[model samples]
Target chain A: MIRAALTLFLALATVSPLWSQSDLKKLSDSEITAFDSKLKSRSQATETLIADFRQEKSMEMLKNKMVSKGVFKYKREDKIAFLYSQPMVYHMIINGQKLRILSNGKNQIIDLKNNPVMREVRTLIAASFLGNLSQVGTTYKISYFDNKGGVVVVVVPQSRQLSSVITRITIYFKGSNAEIERLKIEEGSGSVTEYIFTNQRINTDLTDEDFRIN
Target chain B: MRISGLISSILLVVSLAGCSPLLKEGIWLQNTPFAAGNVPYVYDTIPSTQIFDFTLVFKKSEVTGIVIIKTAGAGERRIVMTSVFGMTFLDFELKGENIKINYCIEQLNREKVILLLKKDFEILFKPDHSKITKYLYSSPDRLDALEQGNGITKTLMKFTNYNNKWPETIQIEHPYLRLSLLLKKTEYDPESI
Candidate 1:
């Protein structure tokens, strides 16, 4: 009897958890509406998002997983700053009209209108987080998939210009409030960056200094 | 006719002088273009995370990113620089003598800019030993190589603080192109996390 129990335990241990994860099924119209409504209502209550995030980057060039850890702050309307603390301190922020990058103690302000590529990227990140995937013009072909636990929305860029850099973006949503669990960005040049959120506190009050560009 | 013959002879002598074979003859070997001052490091091909204060001089703009170099793997040498936002600025591979660009953003993807980038990496990674006609050691830590051409391109490399056969710092000066790269070392291990 002990031997049988031991065999069963080993079988459970050996079985991969991947099978248990969501298998991304087509959501019905009602399901999509429900998700949209849930996102809209929750985003209303949640004015600020403060989360400790882990970013995993894999490329053809990287022999090992290029892992980077950082903190992310997001405010409604349009304000987000991703500050990478591990390995070094570098900040990428989008506050108001300027797109700012702080690296190696030097700050640079780039106009968003002149650069279409970064403009699209900024759109991609913002729209994905808010769950309003269709807000970023008509350049992307968006699709929605849902599992028992969460929903995965895949956004594929159709434009020749945007497609050169970003191939697709997958946003995974979980929890009843439709919290953004993970975001995966695949580049056309054979690289993937996955941002996983942890310790995500909703409705946290963040000041303007928190999202300062400089 | 005699004066013309004298001029031709002088020209011939000058051309022959330009082709002097002994300029780069001493201890000539493959892959030692400027001839490294000492043995180079045998770093793990996995590539440690290297962050340099990157600057595109003519553009007069500077941004920083982690410069990743994967030398030990198969195919060409892969170099990737990404911002803190996880945005990739430059991604390319060096295969033999040619560089195959996988992707470069629109900002740095101009024809002339791409050509300069190709030349810059070539200068940084590959020594211009083919054009090198002279090599002199200014100091134990400094080595200067002179390339013979209409305009001799001088490459000055200083490796002062080296431990474990690795250069702690590397500086490259391209006279024609007002470009300089300063790479500083840092501890980058992805597996630890």
Candidate 2:
């Protein structure tokens, strides 16, 4: 009886190791599925965000030793405008396919097809504003955590060119609504651009006249 | 033949008579050369913050340029500047050595602008021996004739007068644009600020 008991005990111990390994594998697979589901849910949640955002940008250049301030406006996926009020007067407006840049009271209209970088930047901003969080993941490795006021999303670029210019981008989401409170872009060359958003309104009526290039 | 020879002789005598006054005076017949010695030298140890509007114009063929600086002080320096046009270019505040320049427009060649501005400032304030040599060699007689209290303007004016080359008139020749500038006026007063 003692010999039989010893053989059974040894067999059980060997089988137990295999059982635990398979159990861990199953747990990992389920965890991955849950994570994917969570990502999909978050992406879906962001799809309903359509609004006008006001951004105040601060630009710093090391050689120039100046801190520049500018205002940025974005409406949905189509229109955007950047205005610099100090040192010089400069304005750029992009409404759909048409882009107009006014410098020193002279206006220049540039085709959007040839300017891929501007298009990409505009798309990135649009995507973020529309809550296409998954698209951001395609361009950036994103990590999120809760902060004192809201959620903080940190994005690190996946592309070499983007990574070269921008080291990291931090987005602060206000409240539970995921409205961007602030966006900070830090460059590899020690230049930084900080944008603070205020007085954001979603689905408000913005006319086509408001986006006129002039 | 004798009559023609007599006519020629009379003409030569008339010409010699006209030239006699210049020979007696032993000076150029046009005018006495204006001396630059009468101008007064004015120096001010201005706070870097006092400079408001700054412009730099380079020679067309050469890399050298003259920098024009203007300032407004209402307790502190608030500088406003533009390029050739009244197009506002850079705005900055200076506290001691710390200078802040904010660009009004973003250009593709921003690095070039920054570099040119840096070089301009260095030429303006820094005591560079090589620059002094270059300035002197460009107008050797001007420096030689530079009298005390004449300052840079008198030296420049004399150089322009003698060489017919205005070193202060800067020209910038580039592939895209050619720029020429003449320094119209300059005013500096530390006590007023």
Candidate 3:
């Protein structure tokens, strides 16, 4: 009887780690669902979001040379403007039907109806700008972490196609509120873009006419 | 006889005037063929070693930045390009006919640029015999005609209309940014010491 009890205790000890792992997984799933619920609720409450963004892009030339920097602006409902101030002066605006690029007093308009790449980029930016966090689950495997201030959501792309370009994206919020503090996107090619939001004014009087490509 | 001689002189002057502009235009286009040899070198033999500097300007939307490229290659061909601010962007190797573009920014749609550059480089150095023959034969006849003019030379041809040479100055007239690049101060080191 003593030998049998000792054998049973050893078997239980060996199985404990597996049980703990399953429990941890269950906890992670619950956290992810809760995080999704929080984002969905916040997005539903907000009407619109607008912010100023700075973008830096690096290009490799010939061997191992890199040069990068740029700035842009983002508004709610797929309105974006980019201005490159270095090397040259160029401006681009993506409105509803057209993508307009103005440089050297010349305007070139590309109809976005047939441009697949532009459509994809626009969709990605619009989804993020509108705070459609639930749609993010379609493309990414999301994990959530709760800290003192708010929630930190790390989104890793699920599809191989998405993962080939973007490795992960991290978004930070203030408390359980839907207000986002920052977003960082890391690419598989060892590039990162971080956007910090400040002085955010939600639902201020903004007209659709403001997005005209002038 | 005097009337006939005077008419002949006037006709000669008019003909000369007409021919002068045509000759000048011919010389202009000959001196600057829009696109010429792919790489900087003239011969088909790939050098054992090479070093050069390049400046690239990109205009997207309303933003513009200058990128400087410095390259040094040895053995099979290893290239290291850096920006003017000393940021290493791309490092790759080219062994014989194979090219490997090691690093590129993911956000930028630059795959086409890389493939084009690789093809151009291949054409520039160690050109295939058939392609070279086709290029020599099928090149624009206007360029061929311009080559006959006295102003253009094999060593150096200056363009009066556009202030740059082949493989040095690239003109990109985009809707967003019209860029003119001057590839200045080039040196070629051929010996592999």
Q: DockQ numbers for every candidate?
A: 0.33, 0.03, 0.08
Of candidate 1 chain A, the 10-residue stretch with the lowest lDDT total is A15-24
lDDT of 3 at B63: 25
lDDT of 2 by residue, A112-194 (tens): 77654456556656656666654555877766555654656667878775565556777776645556777776654344555
**Model 2 lDDT per residue over B1-193, tens place:** 9999999999987865553221232222122232222111111224332222223333332111112243333222333343211123354544334556643333322766554444333222321211221122222223211211112111111122222322222222121223222222222222232
- Candidate 1, residue B125: how far the Cα is off, in Å: 3.5
lDDT of 3 by residue, A37-101 (tens): 76666666555555544433333233322222244455666776555454345566788767776
Model 1 agreement with the true structure over A1-214: per-residue lDDT tens digits: 9999999988877774644544458778888888887877777777788899888888665556667788998887678888889766778788766788776677888877866766776787677557676566688988778766688878899998778778888888895678888988888667788999989987788888777765
lDDT of 2 at A65: 24
Please rank every candidate by lDDT, starting with the best.
1, 3, 2
Cα lDDT of candidate 3 equals 0.47
Q: lDDT per residue, candidate 3, B118-143, as tens digits? A: 44333333332122121121133211
Q: Among these predicted structures, which one has the highest DockQ?
A: 1
Using lDDT as the measure, name the better of candidate 2 and candidate 3: 3
- Stretches of model 2 off by over 4 angstroms after superposition: A1-72, A84-89, A111-117, B1-193
